[model samples]
Target: MIGLEVSGGIWKATINRPEKANSLTAAMLTELAEIAERAGHEGARALVLTGAGRVFSAGADLEEAHAGLATNPVWERLSGAIAALPCLTIAALNGTVAGGAMGMVLACDLRVMVAGGKVFYPVMKLGFLPQPSDVPRLRSLVGPSRAAMILMAGQKITAEEAMSWGLIDRVVDAEALPDTVHALAADSVGASPAHATAIKRMIWA
Candidate 1:
């Protein structure tokens, strides 16, 4: 399930599926789009993407992945909306983030990964390649060499290493992650909404 919580000017969308490591199903992706649209139009200044389990997200459920690619197309549409969100989008990586989950992280303007967690985008293992637009974002976050290693070599980096590689803006203990993210989101909202929106549009463009 996907859940939305609006508090203190932050719109947080959480992936709730602890039993399945928060792996996203098709429905959840659609719900994400709906939440993003509503929050964007509602004039939210910040957004936090997270999960309600030990793992942030394991990416697409393997059984549903092919159908998602062919029939549903939820992944593309929802992720695109996230990337184009008018506000500052923060990814609070409380736990493991992998596979298709990496796309969502890349969509965010900033990412914070918890200690001991890991993140890897292994689209090559699925016999596919990431879309062209994702390439630049990944490069901007981690530089071309590390991005190439992730996509081409499929290297899975620990959160500490990911922080060192610049994939994540900060690394913190799991217990402290939420508060830290909330504080960051609050700071983002302190800026003029118009300026933030313009900057977001330009950066994503």
Candidate 2:
């Protein structure tokens, strides 16, 4: 359930399984990782990760998680691929982000969410550890204490709270999400890949 569109040096990947809250499966995660990896080599100046429904992702599909997807290396591969991209990466969070899905979202250089979207990782409750690389990124964005509030206390943070805590970069209504993402991506998309990469590294640095 992954859809990708490439135009004018911008790559937009969408998770298309909204019926199950866009929960990811092994194949879907693999495709996402492949897309991220390809974007790095395919001259993409900007890459946007987004979902196709009311929820970005409820994380891994429950059945698949029970069948060993919980500890799959693909999760790390996907997040790492996105993290290693030289071009700018943006997570256009269409809705709530939960569980293992937090990995890819946190790996992005920028995050913009729709209004009323919530963010949480229920690893403690679900008996699965958070994805390896996700921890430090999460900690970096929201700080140790707030990260503890979500990862340790299993707190569900709303979009507004996430913004104040430094998690979400921008929050806008659903209708405005596309425009917001487009605006954020325009400059990067228009630049050469190497130019965009250099600026991204400087900002990230």
Candidate 3:
């Protein structure tokens, strides 16, 4: 499921399914979309998406997939909401990210990952394609060549490689992750909220 907490102008959303490696279900995706919408309406200065345990997310739940539950629409809605939030948004990747979860990571305005964490896209291996919206976003962040490496080659990009490719903003030791994200949130909270929102919208436009 999704866990939400708001304090000091920062909203945090955590995927709380450690036993399953935080693999998202239909209900979880719905809750996440609602949380993202609420964060916007409540005028939080910053929003952070992370996982409860070591794995950020294992992506869509295969069990749900077998049950004919299509997660694409809900996932799209959630990621879109995160991307369109007026305030700054961050994906504090506490650990590895894989599959459809990469869309959520890419949607964030900035990303900070643990040094040993990795990002793996299994599109080619699984015989699936990246979402239409996700393709351009990934391409814009890391360019077409790297995007190809991820989508076509099914590459597992290490934190250092991801940082060098411009996919992630920062990489820090696991123990420093929380403090780093807190400092970033504090800085965003100190900025002029209205200006930050306007600039973010303008840049996206």
lDDT (Cα, tens digit) per residue for candidate 3, span 1-205: 7888888899999999999999989889889889889988988899999999899998888888546433358778988999889998999999999988888889999999998999987878876667667899999999999999999988899999999999999999989988899998776688888988878888888
Candidate 3 segments exceeding 4 Å error? 69-71
For model 1, residues 1-205, the per-residue Cα lDDT tens digits are: 9988998779999999989999878778889878877878888888899998789999888788776542355666766878778899999998999877777788888899888898888887787667555688789888999998888899889988988888888999989998999888776688888888887778767
Clash counts per candidate, in order, are 0, 0, 0
Instruction: Report residue 182 deviation for candidate 1 (angstroms).
Output: 1.2
List TM-scores for all candidates, in order. 0.91, 0.98, 0.95
Clashes of 2: 0
Error of 1 at 75 (Å): 1.9
Ranking by TM-score: 2, 3, 1
List of clashing residue pairs for candidate 2: none
Error of 1 at 8 (Å): 1.9
TM-score of 3: 0.95
> Candidate 1: which pairs clash?
none
Q: How many backbone clashes does candidate 1 have?
A: 0
Writing each residue's lDDT as its tens digit, candidate 2 over 56-126 gives: 99999999999999999999999999999998899999999999999999999999999999999999999
Q: lDDT of all predictions, in order shown?
A: 0.83, 0.94, 0.88
